[model samples]
Target: MTAVVALLRAVNVGSRTVRSAELKAVATSLGHTEVVTYVNSGNLVLVPADGASPDDVAAGLSAAFESQYGFAVPVVARTAAEWELVVRALPFRAEAESDRSHLVVYCWDGVPDVASIRTFDASVYGNETVIWHGRETYAYYPDGIGRSKLTLPVLSKAAGRVGTARNWRTVLALQKLAQERS
Candidate 1:
C-alpha cells in the first residue's frame, strides 16, 4: 500500500463545507487504510488498498466525496515520495522560511503545459511570483494571498486546469503525515 495525500479543492469555503470526519469516512469507504484528515480544509492522508496509483486514488476519492456530499469536490493526490520532492523543490525557500503563510503550492490534477502557464500575464498581479514545476505550481504572495489579484481562478484559467492550493505550512504538514503513514 502506498501512502497518498489527497487534497480537495475549494472545500470549507463559501457553501462547499466538508467536515473532516466525513472526509475520513469517504476515504475509509474507498478501501483506503489508515485514513487520516488534517485540519478542516480537506487534507486527507491514507494508504490506498491494493497499492493503487495516486491518480486512481484521486479519481476514486473525488467520486466518493461527491457522492457523499452532493457536490463535486475535485481531488489531487500525490504519493509520499512525490510530496517529498514537492517540499524539496520549493522555489522560494528564503521567502518560505520568512513567511510560510505567504507561500502557496498549487497541485494540479495532471502536469500542465509549461508553455501555456507562461502565457499568464504575471505583470498584472504586481509582486506575486508563480513558478511551475512538474505537477505543482509554487506561488509567493508578497502582499499576502487575500490582497493579491493572482487568485486561484486566474491561475487555473492560465494553466487550463483545476487545482488546489495549500499554504507552505500545510504542504509540509501533509508531507510529514504522509511520510509517517508510509
Candidate 2:
C-alpha cells in the first residue's frame, strides 16, 4: 500500500455541509484504509490499495462522492513525499517578526507560475503579501486572510485553476500524519 494525502476543496463551507466523519467514511469505501481526517477542512491521510495510481485514487473518490451524495466532487491527491517537499519549500521562515500571519495553500497537478507570483511583493500590502503559482502559495496578512487580497478566490481567478488552501498549521499536521503512517 502507498500512503497518500487527499486535500479536498470546499468541504464544510457554507451549505455544502460535509462532515469530517462522512469524508472519512467515503474515503474508506473508496478503498483507502487507515483513514483519518484532520479537522473539518478536508485534510486526510490514508493508504491506498496496491497498484493504485494517485489518479485512480482521485477518480474513485470523486465517483464515490457523487454516487453517495448525489453531487459531483473534485479531489486532489499527493504522495506523502510530495507533500513533505511542498512544506520544505516554504519561501519564508517564521523568524520574521512580521511573518506571524504567513500562510501557504496546498495544491496539485499545476505548474508554479513565476510571472504572476513575482508581480506582487511584500511591499504591496505593507505587512501583508501573497505569492501564488501552481500547487503552492505563500501569503502573509498582518490583518488577516479574510481582509487580504491574497485569498484563494482572488488568486484562482488569476491562476485559472481550482485548488485547495491550507494554513501552515494544517500543512504541518498533514505532514506529521503522513510521516507517522509511513
Candidate 3:
C-alpha cells in the first residue's frame, strides 16, 4: 500500500463545510485503508487501493465527496515522497522566520508553466515573494495573508492554476503524518 496525502480545497471555508470525520468515513468507504484526517480543513492521509494513481485517488475522493455532500470539491493528491520533496524545496524560508504562519505552499493538480507564473507582476506587493516550481508555489505574505494584496484569488489568476494553500505548520504536519503512515 502506498501512502497518499490529499489536500482538499474550499472545505470549511465560505459555504463549503465538511467534517473531517465524515471525510475519513468517505475514504474508508472508497476502499482506502488507514484513513486519517488532520484538522477540519480537508487534509487526509490514506493508503491508496492497489494500483491507484494519485490522480485516481483524488478524483475518486472528490467524486464521492461531491455525490455525498452535494458540492464539487477539488482535491490535490501527492505521494508521500512527492510531498516531502515539496516541503524540502520550499523557497522563502527566511520569511517564515518572522511569521511562519504567513508562509504558505500552494499545490495544484500539476506543475504550472514557470513563464506563466512569472508573468504576473507580483511586484505590486513589494514585500511579498512568490517562487513557482514544479506543482508547488512557495509564497510569503509578509503582512499576513489575510491583509496582503497577493491573495489566493490573485494568485490563482496569475499562476493560471487554481490550487489550495496551506500554511507552513499545516504543510509540516501533513508531511509528518504522511511520513509516519509511510
Candidate 4:
C-alpha cells in the first residue's frame, strides 16, 4: 500500500468548485485508504488499493472526480518516494525558506519538453526564476506572483504542458503527509 500524492489542477478556483469533503469521498470510493486532503485546493495523500501505480491512481482519481463533479479535473500524482525527491530537488531552496509564498512548484502529468523550457525567454518576466527538474518546475516570483508577469499560462506555454502550482509550504506539507502515510 504505497502512498500517492495527487494534485488536481484548477479546482476550487472560479466556478470550478470542488468541496474538500466531496473530494475525500471520491477518493474513498475509489478504494484508496488513509485518505487525507490538505486545504481546499485539491492536495490529496492516500494509499492506493491493490497496489496501484501512482499513474494509475492519478488516472482513476481524475476520472472519478470528473464523473462525480460533472467537470474534468486533471490530476498529477507521484509516489511518496518521488515526492521526497521533488522536495530535495527544489531549485529555490533559499528563497523558499525565506518567502515560501513566492516560491511555487508546478507538477505536470509528465515531464514537459525540456528543449522548450530551455529556450524560454524568462527575462521578460523581470527577476522571476524558472527551473525545470524531473516532472516539476520550480518558479520564484521576487515581486510576488500577483505582481509578476510570469503567469501560469505563460509558463505552461513555454513548458509545452499545463500544470498545477503549489506554494513551497504546501509542497512540504503534502510531502510530510504522504511520507507519514507511506
Candidate 5:
C-alpha cells in the first residue's frame, strides 16, 4: 500500500463547505486505511487501497464529495514519496513561513505547459515568482495574496488548469503529517 495525501481545492472555504471528518470517512470507504485530516482545507493522509492508482483514489473522493455536497470538488493526490520530494525541493525552506504569501500545489492530471508557467506576467509582484516542480507549481508572493496581481484566477486563465493554494504553514504541516505516517 502506498501512502497518499489527497488535497482538495476550494472546499470548505466560505459558503461551500464539506466537513473534514466526512472527507476522512469517504476516503476510508474507498479502501484507504489510517485516514487522517489536517486543518480544514481538505488535506488527508492515508494508505491507498492495494492496486489503486492516484487518480482512482482522487476520483472516488471527488465523486463522494459531489454526491454529498451537490457540487463537484476536484481532488489532487500525492504519494508520500512525491510529497517528501516537494518538501526537499522547496527553494526557501529556512525562510519564515509568514513571509511568503501563498504556496500553490498544482494537481498532476496532465502535462504542464512550461510556456504557460514562464509566460505568466507578475512584474507587479516583484519578488514573487512561480516555480514548477513536477506536477505541482509553487508560488511565493512577498505581498499578500489578495493584493498581489498573481491571483489564482490569473493562473487559471493562463495555465488553463485547476490548482489549489495553501499558506506556507499549511504546506509544512502536511509535510509533517507525511513524516509522522512514514
Candidate 6:
C-alpha cells in the first residue's frame, strides 16, 4: 500500500461547499484506508488500495466527488514520498516557522507551464517571493496573503493548470498524519 495525499481544488469555497465527513466517506468507499482529513478545504491523507497509481486515485476521487456533490472538484494527488520531497524543498523554512499562515505550497497535478514562473519578476512584489521547485511552487507573503498581489487566482493563472495549496501548518499536520498511518 502507498500513502497518498489528495489536495482538492475549489472545495468549501464560494458557492461550492463540501463537508469533511462526506469526503472521508468517499475515500473509504473507494477502498482507501487510514483516511484522514485535515480541514474543510479538502486535504486528505490515506493509503491507496493495492496497485492504484496516484493519478488513478486522484481521478477516482474527483469523479466520485463530482458525481455525488453535483459539482466538479479537481484533485491533485501525490504519494507519501513525493509529499516528503515537496516538504523538504520548501525554500522559506524560516518564514514557515514564523508565520505559517503566510507560507503556502502549491502542488500541481503535473509540471506547470514554465513561462509564467520563468518570466515572473520577484522584484515587482515587495517582501514576497514565488519559487518554482519541481512540481510544486512555494510562495511566501510576509505582509500577509490578504494584502499581497499574489492571490490564489493569480497563481492559478500563472501555473496555467489546476492546483491546490496548503498553508505550512496544514502541510506539517498532513505529514504527521500520514506518518502515523505509515
- Cα error, candidate 5, residue 178 (Å): 2.0
Candidate 4 clashes between residue pairs 3 or more apart in a chain or in different chains? none
Give the alpha-carbon lDDT of every model. Answer: 0.89, 0.72, 0.87, 0.89, 0.74, 0.86
**What stretches of model 5 exceed 4 Å from their correct place?**
94-108, 124-127
TM-score of each: 0.96, 0.84, 0.94, 0.96, 0.87, 0.93
Q: Write the per-residue lDDT of candidate 3 for residues 79-98, one digit (tens) a residue.
A: 99999998889776676666
Over 1-182, each residue of candidate 5 has an lDDT whose tens digit, in order, gives: 66787888788878888788888888888778888999877889888888577778888889988887888788888778887787777775535454644554455554466788677766755667777666766777665566677776676656666666667777678887876776
List residue ranges in candidate 4 displaced over 4 A: none
lDDT of 2 by residue, 1-182 (tens): 55788887776777777888999998887768888899987777888866577677777877887788777677778888888887777776762335444566647446555565556455654566655544776666667667665566666554556667778778888989988877
Model 6 TM: 0.93
- Per-model RMSD to reference: 1.0, 2.8, 1.4, 1.1, 2.2, 1.5
- Model 3, stretches more than 4 Å misplaced? none
**Lowest-scoring 10 consecutive residues by lDDT in candidate 2?**
94-103
Clashing pairs in 2: none
Q: What's the residue-level lDDT of 152 in candidate 4?
A: 80
Q: Which sections of candidate 2 miss by over 4 Å?
A: 95-101, 112-127, 132-134
Q: What TM-score does prediction 2 earn? A: 0.84
- In Å, residue 66's CA in model 3 sits off its true spot by 1.1
Superposition error at 81 for model 2 (Å): 0.2
lDDT per residue as tens, model 1, 1-182: 66999999988989898799988888998889999999999899999988999999989988987888788989999999999999999989899879888999999988886788878777688898889888899999888888888988888887878899999999989998998998
**Which pairs clash inside model 6?**
none
